[model samples]
Target: MQLHDFYLSGNCYKVRLFLGLIAQPAELVNVDLPRGAQKRPEFLALNPRGQVPVLVDDGQPLVDSQAILVYLARRYADTHWHPQDAFSQGQIAGWLSLTANEIHNGVARARVGLKFGRPVDLEDAQARGRQVLELVNAHLANRSWLVGEQPTIADVAVYPYLAMAEEGGLELAPYPHLNSWIARIRALPGYVDLPRF
Candidate 1:
């Protein structure tokens, strides 16, 4: 198995974190996003969208971090990582969607601007990021995990960018529940460290 990854990407980091949590080993192929490696011909052949965190397993390449998490959860992780029940699946899918949309547009985008010198509306992005932090913080107030009793792909999916929110200039200290959740994820066995720039 192999993961075409960009070291500073939260999306790529989430995939790597899941692989670590599930004890799955994959060769990490660095795609230098800063150098435009993801847009090259060979890389485009691997992922037409030219995104990082493409997982190639058994000769099949999976694109998009959320999709990659679903694939890994079903194929390699413990049953708890992705329960088979419909309600649980639905709940998990919601969190995944949140990761793709709100988190992606908010904290993730802000990080790109603040930490990587990318262009973005920092104020608006941080505003959305704070809203996400509040929503998740409220949801997690009475629950240890996002979907069910155990840590699921939902937790893994949302953890990366949120964990790195302070880098985007959004303070994490205001949300105690969110902080607790971050601690829980970090304490999990085989948990991987957040990506560094």
Candidate 2:
């Protein structure tokens, strides 16, 4: 399998982290996002959206980080990472939504926008990102992991951006529970530092 991704993108890092956790090795083909290498004709043929973390397996391409995580869980591990119960699966889905909507939008977008010299609505993004963090911190107050007591793909899916929220100026100091949880996740085996996208 070949995973085409930008080294520093949080979205891309999510997939890489999952693969590492499962010990699934794949060739990484770096797609230069800032240089617009993803917009090239050859790359566009793989994904119409021109995004990173495009997984190519058996000549088929899978776009989007969340989708690729699901695919990896389904294809690689038929275990607790995805879970068996309907409600548990739903919970995982819920976390995935938060990762994509709140985490990805409020945190990832603002961080990337500001770093790239783009116009980022700092006030709006920061407020919304804080709201998301508050929600996550509250939910995590009584639990060890997001979807289940065990660390699932949902946890892996969301950790990087939230941990590095400070990079975008989103502080984690206020949420002690979140800080503790982030520490736990970081301590897990097979953990890798998120590469700058």
For candidate 1, the C-alpha RMSD (Å) to the true structure equals 0.6
Q: In candidate 1, where is summed lDDT lowest over 10 consecutive residues? A: 5-14
* Candidate 1 residue pairs in backbone clash: none
lDDT per residue for candidate 2 within 81-175, as digits (tens), equals 89978999899999998888888778776787676667888878888889988988998999999977789889988898888788778889999
Which ranges of candidate 2 are over 4 A from the true structure? none
Give each model a TM-score: 0.99, 0.96
- Model 2: weakest 10-residue lDDT segment is 109-118
Q: List the residue pairs that clash in candidate 2.
A: 8-196, 8-197, 9-197
TM-score of 2: 0.96
lDDT against true structure, model 1 = 0.95
lDDT of 2 at 58: 89
